[model samples]
Target: MPRLAQPAGSEDAQDPVALLGNLVKASILRYVRSHPGSTIRPICDALALVSTTVQPRLNELEAAGLVTSDPPWAEGTDRRGIVVRYSVNDEAVTDLYLRLGMALGEF
Candidate 1:
């Protein structure tokens, strides 16, 4: 297995790459869970990000098993575009988020 770099003060020797990957995944996961059946465009809008940036992050999160896309479908407009819906693996991502929040006094 490939090793990820550990985050600062991560005494567990967890790979940092994987940790950062999880953070990105968590962001997507949180957003998806909060807003299911949403498209990439709206997701980008909610995050204040551009499609270019959001799409790649979505793809990466999908590869990381944190998100899944829905089938291509048409919305109100006649134009055809993929309505990417996302679902998060709650157990993993939520636990991490909770821990981070507790650590940061946000919980």
Candidate 2:
């Protein structure tokens, strides 16, 4: 992995229509990848994001096949807990990161 540069808002927002979507997706993917085996709580904490703010992003990433929720596990009788730990679906996200870096340059 190359030393990934921090994304600057100005850099990411450049050509907003064509690149912003991928920039946001790449940001989320990098977040998920860095926090492997992490639940939304940690993600929120690390990014200073609210649950409401993070949930939709998580849903978007999951829907895009870049993340998967852990299987439900028994908590007690007649109860179960679902924990979602996100991981980067390596190939898709890494490729996006590479492309975005090449196209957008660094922050």
Candidate 3:
């Protein structure tokens, strides 16, 4: 696998290849793209994964700005233990891929 050489701490977001290369991450991405407002449980059910797997991926995606979540607290739900909904940040994904293409040249 080809990779771009970069300085330390330069990876502000996820590596595009790493994100797409993993089966679980790719599936989560596709699912959120199709079902924009899906939460953890639904995503787990649809993908047949457990929360331990799904949650961290979602967190990574969120941290990388690939995915956005509207938590219940932010919406004034006042409900305890309400799971947040996940959605693809289309603009961010576009930016990520654009950078990836530039990095990998012929990618």
Candidate 4:
């Protein structure tokens, strides 16, 4: 058996199942991926989820480094924001996917 190559986000292990297994989290990620720089309301409207459900999970994802709320930190992103925008951390997502592939012995 091979060990995980690198950790994803804040977790000690690079476990994609733990990160993306939940339907809500998965959908949220997909939304953020396609709609980079989306605000909470858009996510809620698109997913048909409530603010309570989206906000906390977004916070969690941001904290985990799987998502980023800092638009200014990224290039070509809108800096003007009364409402914080969300985007998927592409590097982190790639790392997680690679980790998942490794775990499945596809790599």
Q: What is the overall TM-score of model 3 with all chains considered together?
A: 0.71
Give the per-residue lDDT digits (tens) of candidate 3, residues 70-100: 8622333463487688999999888878877
- Estimate the TM-score of every prediction: 0.57, 0.57, 0.71, 0.74
Clashes of each: 6, 0, 0, 0
Per-candidate Cα lDDT values, in order, are 0.60, 0.61, 0.79, 0.80
- The root-mean-square deviation over C-alpha atoms between each candidate and the true structure, in angstroms, is 7.3, 10.6, 5.7, 7.5
Q: Residue 48 in model 1: shift from native, Å?
A: 0.7
Q: After superposition, how far is residue 89 of candidate 2 from its true place, in Å?
A: 0.7
Off by over 4 Å in 1: 1-26, 72-80, 92-107
lDDT, candidate 3, equals 0.79
Worst lDDT run of 10 residues, candidate 4, spans 5-14
Better of 2 and 4 by TM-score: 4
lDDT of 1 by residue, 1-107 (tens): 53855457654323223544645445656688888777877777777778787776776665555565665322343424544566665665555556555655576
Candidate 2 residues 2-32, lDDT tens each? Answer: 5755455645434332322544445666787
**What lDDT does candidate 3 reach at residue 48?**
99
lDDT tens digits, residue span 1-107, model 4:
55644445434234687777588998999999999989989999999999899877887677778999854334444545457888999999999888887776678
Stretches of model 3 off by over 4 angstroms after superposition: 1-14, 18-21, 72-80
Model 4 — TM-score against the truth?
Answer: 0.74
Candidate 4 lDDT score at position 30: 93
